[model samples]
Target: MQNEINIPIILASVRKIGDAFLKQYKQNTIPQSMDELLKQLEDIDVLCLTSLKKDLTATFFHMPWHIGDEFDTESQKESTIKGDYWLCDAMDGAIQYLQHIPGWTINLAFIRDGKPLFSVIYDPLATEMFWAKEGAGAYMNGKPLMVSKKTDLGVMLSVFEYGHQDKSTNQLNKEIGMTVTRLLDNFGIVRNYGPHGLQLAYVGAGRIDLFIQEDIDTYNWIAGMLIAKESGAEILNADGIPWQWGSESLLVARKSITEKYLEIKSLK
Candidate 1:
């Protein structure tokens, strides 16, 4: 028999009551609180999927990647970027909203292999829950989600994070921009929400069609990719390649939808 590597996982329960910073929920509900739903995720990450994830931790601020900064190994050396504890305190900082409610965050964690094994983006403000597992699938608050059927270059809607707008014209930007411009040449809409968890969730839920990013860091992909897969979206590189951690990433929807979008948009 071949040798197998068993991954040990650890996760703690984090409760968020009342209005916290969640992206957007599909529908409005009474109480409008995610405390109970979030509690469920605490177990989903540790008990159900722990074998694939390990060394997990979450905080408001984690990696310090700027617009022009490369997500390659070099980015890790920037000491100026703060650590976990600093971010934890910052999340509950006085000037920030934590001063009043004592709970608000961008849920982040890592698995044993240094990849973003699993994660959730809870924007209580918008009431959106973005969660994922590494390979199995991704979801938002138990409901199945997916990208829009609108793939036409003219009619597609796009999602992006912050750094892409401010960074230099890097290859990541080039590839994405080319894709967006091609789509926009027909009238596609590109939108940026400043968070990957939410961005990925939106795509999976079919709220928007396409979401692209240069930084496929573990934190962003772990939960996001799973949700996309579960929601029936396609995950791969833009040039018809597979998507893997620690590399450039592109998320496309189903072939029928994409083909339809392409035909309607009419890109040569």
Candidate 2:
């Protein structure tokens, strides 16, 4: 199945979209107010979907598809349907983009039976493309990618996101705060670099040692998780169980330090 995928064509399509998106991104001024920011975000989503939905559908007409906007609260409550489909986030870092930050990206994944079969993440500003196939390994700009071999929790760089604020509960916020506190106390550097996909791609590239998040959405995880996994990172739930599509929390870490990270996560 992996061999049958036309990687070059897929990459070209995503790159074309990224290039166009980046051009518009550069033309816009940094949003000066909350209202302006929200407006820009809506505009960007429309621009992304307008191009991406049309191109992807025409490019791979047979596959089913889902975009980030479609997975709202009610839809998320339903179980994931079993089948092959294209899962994409047209603007993975909408906030960063509106703020004129450089951490956004276009994320795409091909999932079969709820497992990623092929994935690609494009950072238009950086012109870096990260991709992976089930057994073919992960890559950035055609070079093979691998997770960090760092074993010392004290010296590792870790990243995380608190998930959507609109849906966050007091309990979820508290857990995120506690986890961030714990990580900051132990790791050399802890920060959030905005886009979830890029953060996971960074782990796959050994740019960061760990990534953890609570209540991650399917679109936020699938592609990047595949890249991290192919680069030899461990994908597990907060409790150290193997991660599945609907897992509430996510932990992607380098192999040598995964157990230690899990231990820290279990701390009272």
Candidate 3:
């Protein structure tokens, strides 16, 4: 497609799809298995996909099938289309959903020329929808979302890796344990409610001061980076790279605090 869709129209479509999926989630209609949950979530993805396809094809007269549907890893890697595609994490926190946790969210983003253009993260349980359009700023439930201005990591509520029971072989999980101890000694602590999407949204919403994780997939963090960035938060990867769609690690915080944390980490 030629990317002719209006921003407002994309937002409206995402909201509709999010609301539809959320209804099923709240009604407990989706099955519990990972396969089943993903299947149902994919159904919603189809709805969003169809809406986008119809609108764009009708208006622009072309639709790229590569971005028109969700697929497995190999299929994605082998995709023919090289630019302007839709990205979706229909179920952002599968484990949480499996365990009946309340932190899971729905993520949708439209990436153009390798950058996020529009994004939305919706928490069905809380009835909160966070969205943003490039250069326009982000909002949650009709109000603008902003990152915290806190400059001190001390007394800051940071979210680290949660749900890691095996500390033996999971290198990142082990690091999170050590980091938690360090933060506790320095007047902070790791609060893990188990969803990276929601944690990033919280940082954007100023509900939390910082969030760091060692490993993450694109689907889990794409919409989040857009939400965080549009809300004025600083995002970086473990290697200090500016956060992007393919980064494997993430560190999100207020700008000043992120600088201090990186400085501190560099010392060890």
Candidate 4:
């Protein structure tokens, strides 16, 4: 599958879109408000999708931000095709981007016959791109990326977050809140970078050891999950089953850390 297309050229085109958006932001062309920035990102997404569509014949799927006047008519649901499908998150850390944070990323994954064939995650601020083809191993900035073998749960840096802020009445949030509270108390340190992609990328790079998020969306976790998996990280759904794109939740970490985390999750 790696030889099916020009990987270098396709990745370069993806990076170009990210670089252009970051350049415009550095030039102060992007507004500070979430509404304004999201509106602008929609336009950027169109440019990206257009460029990708021109280069590949795959069916594309992306978040429905209702970015442009032309976007209103587009279907918000995921699209399935007979050949290949592209899963993209044009701007991963929307909240971080709106807050002028430097941790957001851009993601793209190619799915063929229901399997993830390749993935690329771009961090424009750091000018680093992480990519992997199935069975080819992961890389960052052209260097190989590998997960840390640290198995100690107490010594590992962890990232965790729930989907909602109000946990008082939400059953799922309540359960997640309890789980995250205990994790924070037990793990070395905890964080939520407002973007799941960066968290997964960091785990792949061995910068972070654990990541757990409840009710995550498919587009947000798919690309990074593949990158992490290729880097030798373990990932599972809430039920401790193998991870899938539309799973109810995601728990990705080093092998030992994931085992202990799952044990704790089961007690609840």
Give stretches of model 2 more than 4 Å off: 1-4, 29-39, 70-74, 77-79, 165-170
User: Which residue pairs of candidate 4 clash?
Assistant: none
- Per-residue lDDT of 137-209 in model 1, one digit per residue for the tens? 5566556565676635566676654232334545666655665665555446777655455556667888767
Largest lDDT belongs to which candidate? 2
**Which regions of candidate 3 are displaced past 4 Å?**
26-81, 162-170
What's the residue-level lDDT of 111 in candidate 3?
A: 73
lDDT of each: 0.45, 0.81, 0.68, 0.71
Tell me the tens digit of each residue's lDDT in model 3 across 1-268: 3675475665665566656655655455548577887776566556656765665455435434333222332332232445777676655675465455577776777777767678888776787888888888989988999998876666788877543233366586767666676556653655876767778888899988878776654456668778888899888986577876545567888788787777777776
Tens digit of lDDT per residue, candidate 4, span 171-265?
A: 87666777678778779877776777777888999999988876645567777888899999988976678886446678888777788888886
Model 1 / residue 70 / CA error / Å: 8.7
Clashes of 3: 0
Q: Supply the global lDDT for candidate 2.
A: 0.81
Q: Please name the candidate that would achieve the greatest TM-score relative to the true structure.
A: 2
Query: Each candidate's TM vs. the true structure?
Result: 0.54, 0.90, 0.77, 0.82
Deviation of model 4 at 135, angstroms: 1.3
Runs in model 4 with CA error above 4 Å? 1-3, 26-38, 54-79, 163-170
Evaluate model 2: give its TM-score: 0.90
